[model samples]
Target: MDRINYQHLYYFWMVAKQGSVTAACEILHLAQPTVSGQLAVFEQAVGAKLLRREGRKLVLTDTGRAVFHYAEEIFALGREMAHMLKGRTTERGVRLNIGVSDAMPKLIAYRLMAPVLKMSEPAQIHCVEDKTERLLTEIGLHSIDMMLSDVPATPAAGTRIFNHFLGESVVAVFAAPTLAARYRDDFPRCLNGAPFLLPTTNTALRRSLDQWFDSQQISPVIQAEVEDSALLKTFGAAGAGLFFSPYAVSSEIQRQYGTQMMGLAEGVFERFYAITAQRRLKHPLVAAILENAQQGLFDLLDKPAAAD
Candidate 1:
C-alpha cells in the first residue's frame, strides 16, 4: 500500500488488544459492523489474514503476532507523545526490551541485567529468551532493543545487526560431590571414559567442547545430551553425569545445584556478545550492560580444586 490508513490500523490494533471485534467496538464506541468491516479492509490491504477464530476466541496468526508487536511499540510511543503534549511526564521509567538466546546461561544473563535493576532511575525491564535466529528477527523488526547471545551475529545472518563483544569465559566441568570424587584424580585425563552430560550439538559451546575433547585425546562416556543449560546442570546435580558451564558462573552453579567443580577445560571458552541494530550503542541501560561486562564480569579466576 502506498500509504497506511492510520484509522484502520488503530481499529485493528484495538480489536487485537481486546481479543474480539465486539469488545473493541464497545471501547471504540462504534457499531460491531463498522469495526468488523474495517478489520476486513485492513487485512486485505496487508495482504494477509491477521487473526483467526479458535472456537469462540480470536487467535493471532504468526504474521499477526509480528504485527501486534510493532503495533504495541507504535501505540506506546503515541501515548508518550500525547503525554508530552499535555505537559505530563510518563510515570513509568525507561523501558528496556531484551532478548536472550536460549543457549545463554541463566546466571550470566541475570548478571548482565542486574545493573539495570539498581539504576538510580527506576526502569522497566522485559526479557524474552529464545533461539538466536528468532531473536535476530525480532531485532530486525525493532521489537527488541538488544539481544544477548553466546555467539555473535554474522554478516551471513542477512540482518543489519551489529555485534558488540562483551567478553569470554573459560569452560569448567562440574559434577555432584559423589561424581566429582570419582573423576577428581588426574584432572583432564581422569575425565576419560567418565560419564558426561553435554549440551546438544547445535550450540557454539558444544562445538568448542567437542574440539577440546579431541585435542586432549579424552573420550567421555556420553550419558545424556541436553538442550537447556539449567536442566543439564540439574542432571549433573543429581549425580547423573558431569557437565560443563562457563567458569564465570561456576561458583553459583556449585552453590545452587549442590555440585562441585570437576576441572577447568583449559582451552575451551564461551564467548558472549551484545547484538543491536545500530553500530553505536544509544540505549543507556544497554550501554551500562556492555560496560559492566567488559570491566570485570568475565574475568578469569584462580582455579579451584576439583572436589571440595
Candidate 2:
C-alpha cells in the first residue's frame, strides 16, 4: 500500500537472474547484506513472498516467478531507452522483420537474405511467409518492415508502398531421381504429359506458366495444384511430380531437396520484388539486401530488379 521503489525492484531482478545474493551483489557492486535487504523490502512493498532457498540454490516462489517475468521486460525496456537516448542500439540483437510471399521459393528467399547474416552486424530476422496480398497488408500496417514477393504490388495495393524489383530468374524445373532421368534429355518435349506439380492459379508464376504452356502447346499432366512453394518442392523431391523454382537457386534446390534438375523453364520468368512503405528505401537491413541483390546474388539467373 506504498509507492514501489525501483532500486529495490532492480536489486530483486538482479538477484533473481543471478540466483544468489552474493553474485547479484558482485554485479551490482553492493554488499551482500545490502542486496538481500533490498530484495526483502521489494517483496514487502509488493505484498508478496518472492524468494526461497532450496538446498544450496535460491529459487523464486510461484508469485515471484511471475513478477520476475514482468521485471525482466521492465529492465530490458529501460536499457533500450537508455541505448536509444545515447544513439546506440541495445546489446540485444537488432531485429529485421521480413515478410515473404508463399509464391516465392524458400531457397530463393534464403539466398537473398544470406548477405544480411554475413554482415558485421547481422540482424535477427523474423521471416514470415504468406500470400502477397496478406504480406502487403502487413507492410502497410507497419507490422512487417519489408516484403519479398514474386509479384510486384499493383497500383491498387496502395500509393504509400513502393516496389523495388530485386531481380528475375527463369523457372527451373526439378524432379526426383525417378523422373529426372526420364526427362533429362528431351526437356521441353518430355515436359509434355510429364507429371507436373503446378502452383495455384492465384500466383503470378502460375499465370505466367499458363501463358507459356499455351504458347508452347505443351500440356503437362497436372498432378497437384499446390499453394505452398516449399511443399511443392517436398512433393517434387518425394517423386510425386516435377516442381519449378527460380533458376538462380537451381543448385540449392537440388542440394537441399536431394532432387535433380530437369532443366530450365526457358520462357517462364520468376521475378522478385521488395515491397516497402517507404518510396525512398532507408532501413539499413533493407539497403543491404537490395545492394547485395544488385551486386550479384542473382547474376547467373537474369536481369536486376531495377531494370524492370
Candidate 3:
C-alpha cells in the first residue's frame, strides 16, 4: 500500500490496547465514532481487517496481532524518546528477543539463556516459544533476535538464516519412583510393553527414540504423545508413563519432578542449535550464550554415565 498513516495506526493501537473503541476514546479524549472511523481507515490502508467484534469485546485477528506487535515496539521507542527529551534516565537494558522452539526442553532453553542474565549489564529478555517452522518465519520477519531449536535450519529456509550448533545430549529415560523401580531393573528390555509418555512424532527426539526402540526390538505401550516438553515431563512425573529427556537436565528433572532415571537411550541423542539471521554473531547476549554453551554447558553434560 501507500505510506502508512501513523496517526491511524496510533488510533488502532490505542483501541487494541484498551480492548474497545469506547475505552480508547476515553484515553484519546475523542468520540467513539472518530476512533472507530480511524480504525476502519487504518484497516483499509493496511488491506486487512485488524480487529473483529466478539460479543462486545474486540479481538485481534492474526494480521492484527502482527501489526500490534510492531506497534507496541514503535510506541515503546517513542516513550523512551520522550523520556530522553525530558532529561529522564531510562533503565532499560539491551533488549534480546529470542524465539525458542517448543521441542527444545524448557530446562535446556533456560540453561542456554542463564548466562545472559548473569551479565554485569542489565538485559531485557523476551522469549517466544513456538514450532521450529514458525520461529523460522519470525526470524525472516526480523521479529526475533535469535531462535533456539532442536534441529538446524535447512537450506530451503533461505541463505539469510544461519544455524549455530550449540551441542547435543544423550537422551535418557525417566519415570516416577514406582515406575522406575519396575523398569529400571531390566533396562531396555524392561521398557518393552511398559507404558511410555512420548513426545509427538514431529519432534526429532521422538524420531530418534522410535529408531532406537526399533533397533533394540523394544515395544513400549504408548501412553500419550505430548507436544510440550514440560507437560511431557509432568505426565511422566505423575506416573503416567516413562519418558525420555536430554541427559543434560536429568538431575534437574529428578529434583523438580521427583522422578528416577530408568536408563540411557543408548545412541539416541537430542541436539540443540541456535538459529540466527546474522552470519557472524554480533549481539553480545547471543554471543555470550553461544560461548557459554560451547565452552561448558554441553561439554559438562556430555558424560554418558553422569546420570547413573
Candidate 4:
C-alpha cells in the first residue's frame, strides 16, 4: 500500500472544514505557507486538486469533495483507533459513538447518556439522532458502536442486548387544542374525515401503528405523511393534524407547546429495544452504556403515569 502521511490528510480535512488556507492556518496555528504546501502535497498524493479559488473564496472542487468524504471517515476511524490504544486495559474510559432514534426524544435514550458523562474517566461521546432504519444501517456499517430504538425480533446484524418495555404508555391520537375541541370527546369516535399524522412507511413504529389502525378498521384522514418521527412530533406540536405517538416520547414537546394528548378508542404502545454487535457488547464502554440505559428505563417505568 502507498504510504500517506496522516498529517497531510489532517491538513486537508482542516482546509475543507475551514474553507480557506488562511482560516485553516488560524485554526491549526501553522504558517499559511506551510498549510498551503501540505495541502498541495496531499492533493498531489491523491491525484486530485481538492480545492480551488473562487473569487477570493476557497471552494472544494468535485474531486476535493469526494476526497474529503473519504478523508473524514479515515480521520474519524483514526481518532477511534487512538482512543482504543490509549484506553486502559481495565476500561477506565472510552469514546463511544452512539446512534439513537429521534422518535422518543425525551425518553430513556436521551436520559441514559447521563451515566456515561458521570464516569470518572475522560470519556468522549458522540450521539447521532436518526430514525430506526438509518440508525440500524449505521450500526451495520460499523459507523456507530450501538443504537437505541424501537426493536422487534431483530434489526440489521445486531444482537438484542436489552429486551424490555420502555413503559406501558398509550399512543395518543391528538391535535391542537382547537381541533380536539372540535371533536369534543367524539374524536376518532368516528373516522369523520379528521386529518391524521401518519408515519412514513417501512419504519418499525409505522408498521406497528398501521397494524393497529388496520385492526380497528379505521382509515384516518391523513392530512400529511412524514418520514421522520421527530418531524412528525414537530408537526403534531404545531397542530398541523392529529398524529399517533407514544405519549412518553412526545412528552417534552407536548410540555413545551401545550399540546394535548387525547384518548383514542384504543391505545397503541411501542416496544423499544437496544441493539449492538455481539462482539462489541463485550467492550467495557458498550457495557457501561447498556447498563445506564437499562437502569434509566427501569426508573422511567417506575414513575407514576402522567395525565393525558
Candidate 5:
C-alpha cells in the first residue's frame, strides 16, 4: 500500500462533513476533478471504501465515519500548533480571544473593533458573544482572554483592567401612541396594569426592574418574557407590548423607525467593564487590546453627534 497522503485525507474529511463534493471543493478552493481524483487515490491507499452515493447525497461508509473522527482531531491540533507558533514569532502578535455578553450593543461592539483591525494586524482576534454569566465563566476558565460586560452579580475572580461608566440611561416602559392616548393623563399609571415585555427573571437588569416595581407596588402584566434584550426591543418596536429598556435603545430604535421614548422617572443605568486574568495583564498584546477597548468606548459612545 502507498503512503496515505495527508492532503487527500484533509479533503476527505471536509467532503464527509459537508456531504457534497461540490461543497468540499468550494471550501478547499480546488477544482472538482482534482478533489475527486484525490479522494479516489485516498480510498485506494486506505484499502477500503469511504463514501457511497445515496440518492442525490454522499453518505460516509462505516469506515469513513471512523476515519473522519480522527481526521478532525488531527486537523484541530495542527491549527492550534500553527496559531501558537505565529504568536511566538511576533512581539505584539497574539491570538486574543474575547467573550462578550449579548447585552452589549452590536453596533458598539463592531465600532470598537474596527479601529483595532485597521491600525495593526499584529494580533488575530476572535470574539464570542454569550450571556454575562457564561462569558465571565469563559474568562475565568482561560478559554477566553478577556471580557466586556455589565458587572456580574458577584465579582469575577480577575483583575479589573478598566471600568468605564456608560452613564445613566433611562429605562422606560414604552407603549404605542394609541395606548398612551387611551390612558391619557394617567398613562404612567397605566403601565402598572399594561402587559410588559421583559428580560428573563435571572438577569441583573430584570432583577433591578423587579425591585423598582416592587417598591412602587406596581405589578406589570408581563405578556412575553425573553432572555435576549435585542428581541425585546424588536417586540417593543413592533408594538407587541410595552417594554422596559435603556435610553440607548430608545434612541437607536427612534432613529431607525418612528417611535417614542417614555420617561421611566425611575432613573436606572447599566455600567460596563473590561476584565482580564491577573497574570495576563502583563502580556503585551493583551495590554494593547485593553487600552484600545477603553479608548474606543469613549470615541464610539461619548462623542458628539457631529463626531458620530
Candidate 6:
C-alpha cells in the first residue's frame, strides 16, 4: 500500500553493481552503514531478501538477480532519456527485443520479422539466438519481449508465457543444383541413403522428420545433425547434404543460399508460434507480423508445395 522508495532502490542497485557496500559507498560518496541500511530497507519494502554475505562480498539471491536486472533496465532507460534530451542519441525508433530459437530457420525468422521494418516508423530490432529453454528463461525474466520458435510453448513449464499461433507450413527440402537434379526425379524416395543435413535429435522438427522417414520406410544418411538451422542450410548450400526448411521461406532460402527446392515433404509440417510473456498479443509489430503471415505471405505454403 506504499509507493516504491527510489532512493533505497538506487543504493541497492549500486551495491549490486559494485559487489560490496564499501565499494558502492566509495562511488556514491556515502558512509558504508548508510548504503547497507538502504539495502536492508529495500529488501524489507520488497518483502524479498536481495543479497547474502559470501566472505566480505555480497552475492545476489535468485530474487535479487531479478531485481538487479530490472534495476539495470531502469537506469538504462534513465541514461537513454538523458541522451535523448541532449540530442546525443541517434536511435529514435521503437525498440523490440526478439529471441529466436536455434531450431527456427533463419530465412523464416527474417520473413517473420520483416514486417517490423516496414512499419510507418521502423523499430530497432535486437535479436538473440539461443536454445528454446534458455529463451524461455529470458522470457520469464522479462529480458525479451517475445520469442519466435518452431513449436508452441508447452503449459507444463508453468512460466505464464502465452503462445500466439503465427501459422504452420509443411517442410521443403533444398539442395544445390547438381544435388537437386540428382534427387528431383526420385524426390522423397531419393532421400533414402542420401546425404542429409538435419536438426539434432532433440528438436521437434527432427523428431517429426524421423517419424515421417520411418513411416515411409526410408532411412537417409544424416551427414550431420545440427542444432542451428542456419548452419544446416549453410552445409546444404555447400552441397554437404540436402536440408529441410519451412516452405514459408523456401524462395528466400533458394535466393539467399543459391539452393534449389526439391519439393514439400509429405506429412511433415513446421508449425510456428510467437511466444510472449504477456497473456494477450499486444505489440504492434508482432501483430503486423502475424497479420502478414496469415495473409499472402503463407498463401502458397498453405498448399502442398513451394511457390515457384
TM per prediction:
0.84, 0.69, 0.85, 0.63, 0.57, 0.81
Per-residue lDDT value at 4 in model 1: 81
Descending-TM-score candidate ranking: 3, 1, 6, 2, 4, 5
Who wins the lDDT comparison? 3
Q: Write the per-residue lDDT of candidate 2 for residues 242-294, one digit (tens) a residue.
A: 88888787777888999987777788888888888873368788888898888
lDDT of 4: 0.68
Tens digits of per-residue lDDT, candidate 6, 45-103, equal 89999999999999988788778877876777788899989989555466777899999
What candidate 2 gets wrong by more than 4 Å, as runs, is 1-91, 300-308
Range of the 10 consecutive residues with the lowest summed lDDT in candidate 5: 160-169
Tens-digit per-residue lDDT, 1-308, candidate 3 = 76979899899999999899999999999988888888898899899999999999999887887788788788888998999999998866777899989889999999999998888998889999999998897777667889999999999998899989999998889999999898877778888899999999998889998999999999989999998999999999999999999889888999999999877899998999999987436988889999998897887865655345
Local accuracy of candidate 1 as per-residue lDDT tens digits, 18-115? 89988999999999999999999999999999999998778888778778877877888899899999999885678898999988988888988998
**Candidate 5 residues 1-308, lDDT tens each?**
65668998999999999999999999999999999999999998999999999987899776786677568657866877787788744334455677777776454455445555655556567798898776665555555677766564355344543343433344655656655444435546656777778878866677888887787777888889887666776777677777766554455555653446565637455555566665556655556655666555543453324535
- Give the number of colliding residue pairs in candidate 3: 0
CA-lDDT, candidates in order: 0.87, 0.83, 0.89, 0.68, 0.67, 0.84
Candidate 2 Cα deviation (angstroms), residue 243? 1.3
TM-score of model 1 (CA atoms): 0.84
Q: Where does the lowest 10-residue lDDT sum fall in candidate 1?
A: 297-306
- What is the alpha-carbon RMSD of candidate 4 to the true structure? 6.8
Best-to-worst lDDT order: 3, 1, 6, 2, 4, 5
lDDT of 2: 0.83
Candidate 3 global TM-score: 0.85
